[model samples]
Target chain A: MTVQDVYLLSPEISLVGLALLVMAMDLFVKRKAVLFLMAVVGLALPVALSVMLWMDVQAEPGGRLVGVYGALTVDKFALFFKFLVLGSAALLLAASLDYAKRLTRLQGEFVGLILLSATGMTLLAAATELISIYVSLELTALPLIAMCAFLGSSRSGEAGLKFLILSGLSSALLLYGMTLVYGFTGSTYLTEIGEAMKNPLDPSVPFGGLVILVGVVLMVAGFGFKISSVPFQMWVPDVYQGAPTPVVAFLSVASKAAGFAVLLRVFYVAFPSLEMDWALLFAVLAAISMTFGNLVAMVQTNVKRLLGYSSIAHAGYLMVGLAAVASRIPNGGETSALGSLLFYLGAYTVTNLAAFFAIIGIANKIGGHKIDDFAGMAKRSPLLAAGLTVALVSLIGIPPTGLFIGKIFLFSAAVESDLAWLAVVGVVNSVVSAYYYLKVARLMYMAEPASDEETPASSISLRLALIVSALAVVAVGVAPRILTWATDAAASPLLP
Target chain B: MDLEKFLILSAVLFCIGIYGVLARRNAITVFMSLELMFTAVTLAAVAMSRYVASRQVLANPGDASEAVLQTLLTGQVFALFIIVVAAAEIALGLGIVIAFYRSRETVDISQANLMSR
Candidate 1:
C-alpha cells in the first residue's frame, strides 16, 4: 500500500486510533462519561477526513478513488455511508449517556467496543474486494456480538450466544458463496468477477448457471441475516429485547445500513451480468418480510421487541427499492432506485435514532420497556413523548415526514419498473403498520398515568440528541433537495 | 481429477455442517457445527486455488504478470483469511458460551428463552 492508499483510508484509520485511544484512556481517566464524551468528540476527525475525501471524489474523473490496489474504493457512495455511520455513532453515544453509565465497571470498554465497531462500519462501506469485505464484515460484527451481551444478564448472555452462532453461520454461508464465485471466475476482484460471469461457467444444472445461482442465493441468505429481512429475522427481536438499549439502537440503524451498503456494492459491482431473477427474488422476500414482521409486531408487548419487528418491516420496504431497478430510467428521466434507497436509509437512521433515544430516556427512569409502561407519557414527560410521537408518525409514513417522501420515491420507482404489484404490497403494508406504530402514540396521549409521580427529566445529552434527531426527521421531510442531490451523486458511481 | 470432485466433497461437508447446526442442542455444539461450515469453505478455497492456478499456468505458460499472479492467488489468500476470521469468531463465541454457562449452568439452546414472551 502506498501513501495514497493510506491517505484514502484516513477516516477508517483515524477511527481505529480513536477506538484504541478510548480504551487506553480508560486506564488513566477516572470519569467514564468523559470517555463517552471523548468518543463522540473523536468522531469529528473521521467526519472531517471523509468530507475531504467526498470533495476529492467529486473532483475525480469517475467520482471515485480506487485505493489499496482496488481493494478499497473511495467514492461518493462510500463517503455518504461513512458519514451516516459516523453520524449515527456520535448520536448514539451522546444519547446513551444515562444507559451506558449504568455499566459502572465496564463503561470504558463499552464506549471502546462501540468505537471499534463504528470503525468496522466505515471500512465496510469502502471495502471493494471480497477478502477485504469479509475481514471488514467480521470486524463490524464481533464487537457487536460482545456488545449484545455486554450487560452480562441471563437474557443478554442468551442474546450474545445466539448472535454469535447465527453470525458465524451466516458468515460461513457468505464465504462459501464467495468461494464458489472465486472458483468459477478465477478472481475475487468484483470487476473481474462481473466480467467472468458474463458467460457463466457450467451448463449442466440449475438452468445452466448452477454455480453462480447457488453462490448468489447463499450470499443473499447471509446478507439477509445482516439486514434482518424475514426468515432470517429470528435473531433480531431476541437480541433487541435483551441487548443494551444503546447497542440495540446501533444494531438496528448503523449495522443495517452497513449491511445494505455492502449488499448494494456487491450486487452492482460483482453481479451486473445476472438480471431480473434476483429482482424477483428480492421482491418476493420483501413481501414476506414486511407481511410477517408487521403481523408479529402487532402482538409484541415489549417496546424493544416491537420496534425490532418494525425494523424488519422497514427492511422489506427498502427491498422494494432494491428490486425496482430494471434499468437506467427507461421511462421518465427521474431519480434512480438506488438514490431512493440511500435517501430512505438516511431518513430511517435519524427517525429510528430519535425513537430509540426516547425509549432509552423513558426506560432509564421506569426500568422497563413495556408498551404499557409508556401510558400517559405525554403528561409525564412532554418532550420525550413529543419526540417519540414524531418518530412513530414518520415511521408510519405520514405526511410531513421523511419516510412519507422516501416511500413515495421508492414506490414510484417500483411502479416505473413494472413492479406495481410490489408497490401495492408496500403501501398496504405501510397502512397495516400504522396500527402498531400509532398504538404507542395513542397510549402516551390518551391513557392515564399509573402514578402521580413524574419521571425526572432526561439527561441533558439525551434531551439534546432526541430533539436534534426529531427535527432532522422534519428537515428531511420538508427540504430534501440537498439530501436528494447527495443521494443522487452517491448513486451515480454505481449506475450508468 | 477435475475441480468438480473437490467441489462436491466441499458441498457435502458444508451440508453436513448445516445438518449439525440444526440438529445439535447445545450451544457449543452448534458453534462447533459452524466451525465445520467454515472449514468446508476453507477446503473449497484451497482446492479451487490449486486447480485454477494449474489451469491458468497451462493456458499461458510464460506470460506471468503481477496482476495475473495476484488473481490466481485470490483463492488461497481467501482461504487464509477465512481461517483467521474463524479463529477469531471461535474465540469470541467460546467467551460468550462461557458467559452463558455462568448464568444458566447449561448451554442448551432450547433452555435459553427468557425473552420469548
Candidate 2:
C-alpha cells in the first residue's frame, strides 16, 4: 500500500496505538487513574488525525479519498461516524471511570478493550470492501465479548458466552452471504458490486438473480443481530442485564452506529437498484422491531433490560428512515431520509449515553438495576435523577429533545417517500413507547424514597459526562441546526 | 467439480451448523457448530474462487488486467481471512466457555440462564 492508503487508516491506527499504550501503562503505573487520564488524553491523537483527514478529503476534487486498494473510503460520511464513535468513546471512558473501578484488577484490559473496539468501529465507517467490512466487524465484536465476560461473575460469564456464540454465528452467516454475493457479482468492491447489479439478471439461469437476492437477505439477517432488530434481538436483553453498564452503553451506541454505517453504505452503494425490494424488507423489519420492542419493553423490570428493548424500538425507528430512504429511489428526495437517519443516530448516541452514564452512577450506589430500585431516586440524587428524567423524556421522543425533532424529520421523510403507513406506525409506536419510558421517570419522582439517607457524591467525571451528554441532548433539540447541518452534509454522499 | 454441487454442499453444511447451534445444549458443541458454519463459508469461497472467478478470468484472458485479475481472485483472499478470523473467534469462544464453566461448574448453556427471567 502507498503512503496515502496508510494515511486513510491513520485515525484507526492511532486509536489502536492508544489502546496499546493504555494497556502497557496498566503494567507500570502505581495509580490506576493515570491510565484513565492518559487514555482520555491520548484520544487527541486520533481526533486530530481524523479532522486532518477530513480536511484533506474535503479539499479533494470529489470530496472523497478512496485508498488502500479501494477497501477504504475517506469522506464526510465516514468522517461523520468517526467523529460520532470517537466523541462517544471519550465520553464513555469519562463517564465510566469510577464504574470501571469495579474491574480493579483488570482496569487496563477494560479501557484497552473499549479503545480497541472503538478502533474497529472507526475502521468500519471507512470500509468499502466486503473483506474489510467483515474484518472490521469482528475486530469490533471480539473485544466486546471479552469485556462482557470480564466481570467474572456467573451472570457476566453467561453474557460473554452468549455474546460470543451468537456473534460468531452471525459472522459466519455474514461470510456465507458475502460468498454468495461474490459468486453472483464476481467482485468484492461495493462500487463494482453496484455496477454489476445495475442490470436486472435473468431469473431463469441456474444461480441467476436469486443468488443475489438470497445473499442480500442473509447479509441483512446477519447485520440484524448487530443492530438488535427483531428476530435477532433475543440476546440483547440477556446480555445487557449481565454485562457492565459502560460496555453496554458503548455497544448500544457506537457499535450500533457502525453497523448502520456499513449497512447504509453497502445497501446504498451495492443494492440501490433493488431499493424497492430491500426497502420493503427494511420497512417490515422496522415495524416489527418498533412494535415488539415497545411491547416487550413494557414488561421488563431490569432497567438495563428495559433499555435494551427500548434500543430495539429505536433501531426500528432508524430503519424506518432507511426504508423511507429507499422510497426516494425514484425521485431521489434530497437527503431527507438518510439525513434523518444520521441525525437520529447522533441524537440517540448522546441521549443513550446520558441515560446510561447516570445509570452507571446511580446503579453503582443503588446495588441493583431493577426499575423498582429507582424509586425515590430524585430525592436521593437530584442531579442524576434529573439527568435520567431528561434522557427518558428524550427517549420517548418528547418535545424539545433531539429525538423529537429527529422523529419529525423521519416521519416527514416517510411521508415524502409515499410510505405514510410506515409513518403512521412510527407515530403510534412513539406513543406506546412513552408509556414505559415515563413509567421509569415517574417511579423516580413519585415513589417513596427508600430511607432518605445521605446521598453519596458521584465522581466529578461521571457527573460531567452525564451533564454534558444530557445538555447536548436538550441543546440539540432546542437548537438542532448544527446537528442537522452536520448530519445533512454527512448524509449527502449517499443521496447523490 | 461442478460449482453448483460445491455450493449445495456448503449450503447444506451451513444449515446443519445453524441447526446445531440452535439445538445443542453444550456451549462447546454450539461453538463447534459455529466453526462448521465458518468452514462451510470457507469452502464456498474457495469453490467460488476456483469455479466462478477463475473461469471468468480464463474466459477473457487477453482483456484481464493484473489488478482486475487480483480482484477476481479476491474470493481466495477472502477465504484466507475467514479462516484466520474464525480461528480467533474460536479461541475467544473457548475462553468464554471456560469462564462460564468456572462460575457454574458446567458447560451447559441451559444452566447459564441466570438472566433468563
Interface C-alpha RMSD per candidate, 1 decimal = 2.1, 1.0
Question: For all the predictions, what are the DockQ values?
Answer: 0.70, 0.83
lDDT of 2: 0.89
lDDT of 1: 0.88
For DockQ, the strongest prediction is 2
Q: Each model's C-alpha lDDT?
A: 0.88, 0.89
Candidate 2 has a DockQ of 0.83
Q: Candidate 2 has which clashing residue pairs, if any?
A: none
Give the per-residue lDDT digits (tens) of candidate 2, residues B58-105.
768887678757866788899999999999999998998889999999
The fraction of reference A/B contacts recovered in model 1 reads: 0.79
Residue A344 error for model 2, in Å?
A: 0.5
The digit string of per-residue lDDT tens for model 1 on A386-435 reads 99999999999997888889999899888988898999999999999999
Candidate 1 docking quality: incorrect, acceptable, medium or high: medium
Off by over 4 Å in 2: A200-205
